[model samples]
Target: MPDDSAPRPSEEAVEEAILTVASLPGAAKTVTPEDVARSVAAGPDWQSLLPSVRRGALRLAQAGRLVLYRKGKPVDPSDLRGVYRLGLPPEG
Candidate 1:
């Protein structure tokens, strides 16, 4: 049985959403924060998942598994604001 009482996002859920969406269509594709929020959210109140998504993104960025971008440029996860996108790091 699942704990339906707790509707909040979990770190594992958020991380999975980020990685899953980011890798869905190769490294060139990017997903918005809202995209991840929607993926982990259990209900229509996905807006509430933004904070958790951002936090997960920061952690993934630090671990080098993801990259956060704003205005087409990579931005420090700590400095992200306004609109942002997530994607796998560029291949070398």
Candidate 2:
């Protein structure tokens, strides 16, 4: 089981991991939920944090620092479901 009193990963940490991974050269600068989750997980429990990664992705996307993609097209973060990828928005 999990410890309810245990401190969870910070929202900032999650967002940072998303940005960091997506900013990498490969994968077209995009990342999956599991990517960020594993980066933020304390050990090997990354699977449990998938939802948190998604939520952080939404927050960062809303803040305009990140972009959420579905089916290779940029998407509105608020209406995400199924599978999605995250990346830094194109610089202009």
Candidates in order: C-alpha RMSD to true structure: 3.6, 2.2
lDDT winner among the candidates?
1
Candidate 2 residue lDDT tens string, 1-92: 65556578887788788888888776666778887787777666788888788888888889999999999999998888889988888999
Residue 43 lDDT in candidate 2: 66
Give the Å error, residue 6, model 2: 6.8
Q: In angstroms, give how far residue 78 of model 1 lies from its true place.
A: 2.7
| lDDT (tens digit, per residue) of candidate 1 on 1-92 | 34557657678888998999888865456889888887777666778778888889999999989999999989987798888999899899
Estimate TM-scores for all models.
0.82, 0.83
Candidate 2 lDDT (Cα, whole model)? Answer: 0.83
RMSD (Cα, Å) of model 1:
3.6
